[model samples]
Target: MDPAAEGTTTISPQLAERAERSDLHTLGIEEEYLLVDAVEPRAVETVDEVIDQVPEQMRASVQHEYLRSQIEVASPPQLELSSLYDSMRVLRTTLADAAGRAGSRLVAVGVGPASGPNSRLVDNPRYHRMRERFGDLSPGQGSCGTHVHVSIPDDETGVQVLNHLRVWLPTLQAATANSPVFGGHETGYASWRSVMWERWPTVGPTPYLQSHEQYLTMIADLQASGAMLDEGMLYWYARLSASYPTVEIRMGDVMPTLDDAMLLAALARGLVATLVQEVHAGAVAPDVPHPLLMAAHWRAAKDGLEGTGIDLATREPRPAWRLLRQLVDYVRPELERHGDAELVTVLIDRLRTRGTGAARQRALLAKGTPVAGVVDWLARTTRGEM
Candidate 1:
């Protein structure tokens, strides 16, 4: 044999172990919201006042982003499905109450209702430095989204789990699509947040990687090239968490209600858990390329469910509603495993019929009311007072 051939190793062992236990389900929700003055339609920075007035527990979990107009609410790590929903509901309620005391409201805007030069950045020193470093990354402007974290055993599983999820993320965005307008202009995108985010360094589909080592190598390469500062900047459409041992689904635009938020979180957790199980059982998944998925994502941002979406799996055009219905049934077993079938059914019925938050926002804007109505509507829906 040749010297080079004799020296090379043919195979690599498993980078990590499969998650053995089934009761390992853990979930959390991250809600990015806008702080709005009840009287003004624009975003305002009020995190300080809101946090100060809220209960101590909430104050601890609620954090400000680079923009003062934006605040992120994180649900406590939850072992049970009900607990996840409860934490989200309670947090929203507490924040709403606090906003009331401050003469403001914690409004959830996908892409804010109104936009102008009046937006205020959050006043934290760290945020200030962040704004300086990453000028446009912060919401010093306006846009919001919902992120769901589902804990996995380790990084290897996280990569495999996120790879499987990349295809359907655009589908989720189409179903949850909101943010028809941006900067107060009718941009014509169903989810303007998706469009606005393309300006960021990392906001698109992730290429298929076969194993954990391949995934790590790609990440290391990106970091070495100075394209990314660290693992934290690997903001692929669906990605393994650089910090948490969880998979983060960052597709859905900020929803107006707690029920919608909880439902989305449940779906995310269930999907990840099911995929993790399948990968553990020696299942080999098919390739869904990033370029094709990016096209689908663009369609989702432009038309939402109102237009035909580019199917990532088939590489063809299909109706958004048809695709969504199929996924609901396809994921039924997983939903059942998580004891969330009932809630999933309710969400499907509502989403399938009403279109999405973007559709509703368009209707409200057409009714001759000002953007303030949109802000109030969001506040009401989130508190379940609608």
Candidate 2:
């Protein structure tokens, strides 16, 4: 069955829960990009043309997103961290050149502009059904995001990992807030994409689930209730992959630079490894309440890295960056074990100096650079040209 095909009424078969844990954690990362007019900075319907220009060898890795103005690329799963970075850099450069040749620029933005005409749906059956069912929600569906897929041993392990991963969803959101400006004005929220994405009934930090049986039952219920048309529409922040033996952490907006993206990819892998280890040792995952997690998600979207985040431990506000640091410390040993320690350290420092993508865009606007300038800077940084 095609994962993207809509109208499946029942959940698909998956590996049994509680399979033996495999030590090796491979990584596969996907990033969705927006195609913008080269000069005016509005989203343009040129993804089909740009995709046509991709070299034959890389075609398998690239595909259309829900909107005509968006494209997505995924790296093949790999155990080596350094090689994965090189692979993504190549994809971005290749796609950027292809977009430029098609008279557009590839931007690593979260949400497309609200001022211009809405992006057209991708010319496909699945997308049309989505537009028909979701109504106004489809208009802003051009939002781009970075999805990290890390190998898991089995569905039961993946479900357990999802519970462990839920606590960090807000931290990931705060670090990757990139959609500050839409409609050529400040939206007052750092990751406006997160706000928009929540309109879907299934999208959120994954709920605390008891077993793999519950995971299957939940999807079946959602599908029967019309809240979801297929398993592909289960948009939890983290979930068991339907197509592969992996746990997918897909809560982040696309980062502005490759370094930012790699930092997130590294963190996702490290966190998963740490959690998996804990699971093997019979440790209980945190008993964080759903209400607190929801509040934390909202606060992170409001503040990004520049303001306060809810410390899950204390349920009180702390500097968002401090929370980010606490996360880094928590996963440092796992990162070291995965040989990602040195690279993550350098990337985090760069983030400290450069700030979140939303912050950089705001800084450009504060200097009297128009929205077009912000868009151009985003395009340049996306291709590592600056």
Candidate 3:
């Protein structure tokens, strides 16, 4: 049966109990971007200088990442999708203008073509300690990602949402796979950033937890093991935000356009809302094995939407579009609830036709556009000028 046509199921006891208190679908987005020379498109170490150029009023929204060649911007929590888009656009335009004044450009690609051997760590004691502890994984680490935070009522609901959401995270990764090139070479994966990110000990798909107690215990164990710096370092693809009352999905590469980013945010918020509804309707989370989930993630990272992805329901190879459609169908009710169904449908159609960021980058290279030209295109598209 087509999951999309299915009628609403009964609300579970847990969901029914908290329906009155839940926020439903409030969202916030955070994106990291690479800073590069405006003319040459090479990664540049100027975050400190660029941050100074941002207007005083907007200063708090823009921040430095671990790498000096990278910067991050966050949108204030918003209930309307349009408000989120406007916030992102204003931040991007302001940051781009500031970078321009500093002879740099803010490129939204996953990793800069000029990154690798020369990447510099930001001048901070925390970053210094990370470099000292992680060693090889610390250097040459210049990649960016989009994180979506969807509000939940409390930790118990957040854990259930994470469990239900894990199976679909790979599909999310494939849809947003924007990091095709890294350190000046095509990495043969749509999201080379995922590969680069997995090198960190704490990153990847997390195991299902039975309760909030289990979640906290697991985090405590990881922290005690010295592999993690603290609770804030729990870098699973999705996790309860250490700083917010939301489940943060951190699986997407920084998208090439505002539309792409908003598409991701919409889907993320819809997924959270759908899962919350499922919990209330008394649906049990799927018992997908952790290893199989990891394999699906690897395939999505390897092929993106241009190739096949693992179907979580069957653990078999399926076309990427088919998996995406199933995901949409599964969350259709929630999408409609939040008024995102039309926007998501249109954006998915566009992605299917135009290809993902990796595919787009390859197309440019195939057309005899130099790597620098590719970077310029990404910068222009990021600013919504192209």
Candidate 4:
């Protein structure tokens, strides 16, 4: 049956509820990207051109983001990691082919690697309204990243999961760090997104909360105080999504390839599952270090994996490799049980060596090629054409 064409009245609420409550592994990914042209250096305004050209099966998964130059592709809920790779590959190929037909290409990057004036690339009503309201706060119709969501059984579990997931988020951020340049200038920060996104009215790390009641109070206060326009503005480092029965982690940059994206998603699912089970069994896992979260995030934004991160337990800075070892040990049992042990090993190897996206971008720059060259590099990376 065609999913989009299916009438809303035909859907079963009970079945939907069961799907949300299921304890098995469930994962979803939303990846945002920059639309570029092989001959141009600025943001390429071409969503309509490519959308009109892609096949129907691929078009269903592809859509526009806040900006015209930005395209977001989200995978449907999946029970296994391999299925995610298949969907991602198909959508990416279709989009790339469509862009090619339009005399342009799609590049996945967290920030526009090169600078261009803020202008509408695609004409969408909500995007126009958002730009009008947010003013300069809106990165002005450019930049992109990957957001991962894993199902939670209930609100209580979601809140606790968000709180506990904080410490590991920086590591994930470091692992996927990709944005290094902005406006044609080499932003010293490995992930300048940390600076760019702060312009938004409500965004940043989730503060330490005592319990679920406290989390609710914080949200209510934000709404009342106007710090947030709505519940959507409570953009913590990681948070229980208001609309989805899942914990959403927005720490990572847009990965350049499907393999990296899937690896991160699988790891995220394993972490959430392991932690939720522990919480349900009345087992107290380790406490999150908000201070560590602050410092680690700083290092990730500054050095990617090239620099060391803070060890909250030891109160000292340690190399990313050392920190990653501790983290792998912490999550090894869960990875093994879920048949994702291979991915964990691959990620650990990457962590021990080069940094994630940011490192690759930096290397590409050192070669004396233009930022457009880097975009091309990322395209090849994601398409396995590298």
User: Best by lDDT, which number?
Assistant: 2
lDDT by residue (325-384, candidate 4, tens digit) is 676677778777667788768755754554577788888789897887887787777565
Q: Listing every candidate in turn, what is its Cα RMSD in Å to the true structure after a full C-alpha superposition? A: 8.4, 4.3, 6.9, 4.2
Model 2, 174-286: lDDT tens digits are: 99999998877899989998998899888888988899999999999999998887899999989887877789888888999989998999999999988988887887779
Give candidate 1's root-mean-square deviation (CA, Å). 8.4
Candidate 3 regions with alpha-carbon error over 4 angstroms: 1-23
lDDT of 3 at 194: 87
Q: What is the C-alpha lDDT of each candidate?
A: 0.72, 0.85, 0.83, 0.71
Q: By TM-score, who's the top model here?
A: 2
lDDT tens per residue, model 3, 285-372: 9989989998999999999988999988887899987888888898888888778889888888888888888889989988998888
| Global Cα lDDT for candidate 2 | 0.85
Considering lDDT, where higher is better, how would the candidates rank from best to worst? 2, 3, 1, 4
Q: What shift in Å separates residue 240 of candidate 3 from its native position after superposition?
A: 0.1
RMSD (CA, angstroms), candidate 2:
4.3
- Which one wins by TM-score: 2 or 4? 2
Give me the runs in candidate 1 sitting further than 4 Å from their true place.
Answer: 1-21, 118-130, 137-140
